[model samples]
Target: MKKLSLLILSLGVLFSCQSASSKTEPENNPEIKMEENKTMQQDVTKKKNRIVVFETTMGKIKAELFEDKAPITTNNFITLTEKGYYNNLIFHRVIPNFMIQGGCPEGTGRGGPGYAIKDEFGPGLKHDKAGILSMANAGPNTGGSQFFITTVPTPWLDGKHAIFGQVIEGLDVVLKISEVERNKMDRPLKDVIMTKVYIVNE
Candidate 1:
């Protein structure tokens, strides 16, 4: 009788251990699967999103556009840049220690994309300082591809220019280009064109 009882206890312990191990294994498996799914989702999102590159006459500037934050602004820029609309467009206005404005197909400050996009603001983006690319418009809701790059902090433009992308490289190029001669309106006396604009991923 004692031997039989001992055998039953051993079987009970073995089954209990197996049950515990099985339960723990399922819990860990689900967690691992959830993590894998999350990573896959992130990778898919990144792959779908594109990184835009602006090859200016001064130099190349890269910007990782935020589609999720400013979808309308980002999409507008992507469409315009991809269509070669910005190519050869002159930096019409360049104010010392202020900002440089462009996006006129005719290389004049009065040109535009022929259509306007609704303002996408309050995304925590700010036009605080230099290298911050933003929209150029006569008034709110009038932005139509005309944009600017700051040479210095233009506090007055904080809420004016719709903060889109920023210059991630070759900022000195803008400063040097701005030093070029300009008319009374700060428009470049001699046209400084953006040779070509393209998108590149790093």
Candidate 2:
């Protein structure tokens, strides 16, 4: 009878130890762990990238900035946008079926954000399509705040300018800007003001 009680105690201790071991070893409870992990991942927020939106007098020309390809140029533009640098700035140069250039605070072809940035041109991105946004520079590696959006394919500008982004949602707004009346300098007679150039995460 004593031996039977001893055996029962030993069995009870073994079973208790097994239960404690199972509780401590998370891998043994994969289903619970997986559910917890899923909950954790769901609780973690997804990253959101800002979409460059050109709110002009005509309409909102939404664009997706190519930060991956032109980090320097894109960062410069984003900083300028956050500072409201492009506000009230006119599209100083507009050529039908070609491009529309702006971002010069002076509203002249010769202005910038008081500094220059290196060109981000390469084989990765190019001026292959209309509504493509690119930095306007006097020469190589002289890019600043001044930029242009192609109204058509401009292959010649491929390696010359920093292709930073493209008009994803409002090409028509860009087309309208291209059609505005302009002077001999290609400066618009009527202000094609860029009311705002802002960003939206995601």
Candidate 3:
């Protein structure tokens, strides 16, 4: 009877040990829980803002695309950037106290990707200040790869152009290009090339 009692007690102890081990395993451990939370937070951070980095000859200009507000315009720009279409494009037009225009493959304000995108305008979007990025269109619904960044407040353009994005980090670079020497047509005397444009925060 004593031997039987001893065997039952040992079995109970073994079972208890396994239960404790299982409870403290990696899946249930506090350290693992913290790591999972950290990873989740990192992912959430990435989805908050969509960033685009433009590597220009003057300097790098980082713009935050308004994806929620201008989905078509923002995505179109993102697509062009991913396709390497803006590489080597010069800032073909730069008017002081106004804006700098580019993304013309011909560098003469006459070239585009051979196709135009519909205007994605909406309420509350306006070209009210510097750094505002909007399509350089010939008329209504004529948006294409060509875009401009304002160097000063341009309220007249408000409610006329589709304000798709803005210069979040390099407004100074845009203003600097606006000050470059230009001809009668406002084309830069020397090329202020956009070496590349790419999406960030992937």
Model 1 residue 47 CA deviation in Å: 7.5
lDDT score, candidate 3, position 72: 91
Candidate 2, 39-61: lDDT as tens digits = 88765533333588888888888
Winning model by TM-score: 2
Show pairs that collide, candidate 3: none
Alpha-carbon local distance difference test for all models: 0.80, 0.86, 0.88
Error of 2 at 201 (Å): 3.2
State in Å the error of residue 8, model 2.
1.9
Q: What is the TM-score of each candidate against the true structure?
A: 0.79, 0.80, 0.77
Q: Judge candidate 2 at residue 114 and give its lDDT.
A: 82
RMSD of each: 3.7, 3.5, 5.4
What ranges in model 3 sit over 4 Å off?
1-47
Q: Over the stretch 1-202, how does candidate 3's per-residue lDDT look in tens digits? A: 9999999999999999999998877665798889999999998886665888889999999888888798899888899999999988999999999999998888888888888888888567888789988889888888889999998889898766788888899888998999999999999999999988888874
Which prediction has more favorable lDDT, 2 or 3?
3
lDDT, residue 60, model 3 = 92
